[model samples]
Target chain A: MTTEPRLVEVRKNVLKQNDIIARALRDRFREAGVLAVSFVSSPGSGKTAFLEKTLTLLHSRYRVAALVGDLATENDAARLGRSQVPVKQILTGTVCHLDAAMVQNALDGWDLTQLDFLFIENVGNLVCPSSYDLGEDLRFVLLSVTEGEDKPLKYPTIFNSADVAVITKSDLAAAVEFDEAAVLRNIQAVRPGMEVLKISAKTGEGLAEYLEYLERRCSSSRAGAAASN
Target chain B: MHELSIAMSIVEMAQEESERCGQAQVLAVHLRLGQLSGVVKEALLSSYEMACEATPLEGSQLLIEEVPVEVFCPKCDGPRALGSIQWFCCPECGTPTPEVLHGKELEVVALEIEE
Candidate 1:
């Protein structure tokens, strides 16, 4: 008998299971008619403040819920709860970023069909969050005016992966001498034809336009799903 | 860093693959890491050691193969390695190319196990 060992060729992505779960979540969200939006940014970029403003604006008309992720402390979740909408805190402990598994676990026991919008506030870190998809219908990457305008260039992967870019704290632009034009240019350079919106959560500026854009996206996706069905 | 998390995933995948192959031990895991994959190779290597401790993949080495960013330059009518991340101009001629052929790849290619 010839002594030969069989060599098995197995080519698979380590994140294959995670990707499958994420896809399932996406389909579930679509079927439930929930417009899921997620936010990712570096710490101190006003993500919590932005979400607070968004919840305040959206809760009046739409049934909105939020899931905020952080390394520790429920300060953000507590703060967002003031909006009088359902909010959950995902304490990742030592994890630098939130993954799909975390998102799914956080949503446990909550009826997604009851909500029109779901916002996932990812842990404040730019690098790691871009690698994992949390099954959100839209992913927004936020950059503050105080942050360098070349942030998009420095962290191209985050900007490239984001569906939309939000320039937060625009009220501080003039005080900080922020280069708005350069920031826009850098965003375009990294992801051409990407949707970018400028907003100031403190002053309530540009909030209406952002909401309108979100409404349009949700409706369009709904139309597409209807047609496919 | 997120390297630890990635390393943990690698170890888990290796263990599962070893079990599927009816092997008692994993020798190594081959990974294809592209230049633009946004993963630091040194950090990953160090984290791999820490992540594999007391796990099935203990003592298993992580073999990484680096891949350069390649883009299709319309001017050259072929693919060429991008020297830098900032500029994607043609290597042979001075022309900007918008087509991306390779880059941003982070995947485990294969596993070596003892049967």
Candidate 2:
């Protein structure tokens, strides 16, 4: 008897299942007239703080809910829930990022058509989150002034993947000696024609602009979907 | 790390493939990894071993083929391989091009198995 090991051709994407689920989620979100948005950043980039403020600000005007992901704790979901919005925490345990399956599972029992906007705050990591699209209409990538100006250039993939780049903790820019020009230049260098925003959730500075942007995003996304349909 | 999850996914995929091939023993899983795939090769390889333990892929090998980034350059009127990581620009004309032609692959291409 002869022993032989044969090579079998099985060409398939490892993430094909995730992609299919994500596409279904996106279609459902669009049909329900809900804007699904996500936020990603490095740890301590003020994503939770910014989301807390956003939830509070938009809660009165729109039916808002959030899914917060963390490696270990539900602290972020607890904090965001204080705004009195439906908040759920997806504890990924050791996973560095949230996938579409997690997002879909978390939305169980909730009618998406009832909400105007649904936010998913991803696990605080710039690299991994970029690779996983959670069926979001828009993704905001956050960077704090304290992180240094070259952050976007250092992690260009995240910057390139995000629909918008947010500069958080603007109120502390002066104290931290943050160079706005350098940061802007770096962002432009890495992802040209990228939309950037500056905001401070603590002081409400630029919050108005941020909200307006969100409103515009919701409307435009819905309008685009309606037109395409 | 997410690499562990991805490694598990690979193992699961291998098991399915083996089952489809009449319960053949998978000797190795071949993968095509791209630079833009966002997975660190070393981390994934280490995670693969751990994920395979106590599973059908326990002694199997993961063979990875790294794909280089390629961009569609309008200035060059064609796609070009990015030689360096400094920028996504056309090497000949130095014009920035965001149109990616390749290097996002994270596919399981083949399997070495024995009946």
User: What residue pairs are clashing in model 2?
Assistant: none
Which digits, one per residue and each the tens of the lDDT, describe model 1 over residues B46-95?
Answer: 99999999988888889898888787777788998876665555667746
Q: Between which residue pairs do clashes occur in model 1?
A: none
Best by lDDT: 2
User: Each model's RMSD to truth, in Å?
Assistant: 3.0, 1.7
Candidate 1 lDDT tens digits, A1-229:
4334333455666667777878988998888888999999999999999999999999989999999999989999899999999999999999888889999999999898898899999999999888788999999999999999889888877876788999999999999999999998788766656789999999889998999998898788888777876
Model 1 interface CAPRI class = acceptable
Q: Please write out the lDDT profile of model 2 over residues A1-229, one tens digit for every residue.
A: 6469999998999888888999999999999999999999999999999999999999999999999999999999888879999999999988889999999999999999999999999999988987787999999999999999989878887787788899999999999999999998888766666789999999999999999999999999889888988
lDDT of 1 at B97: 58
Q: What is the model-wide C-alpha lDDT for candidate 2?
A: 0.90
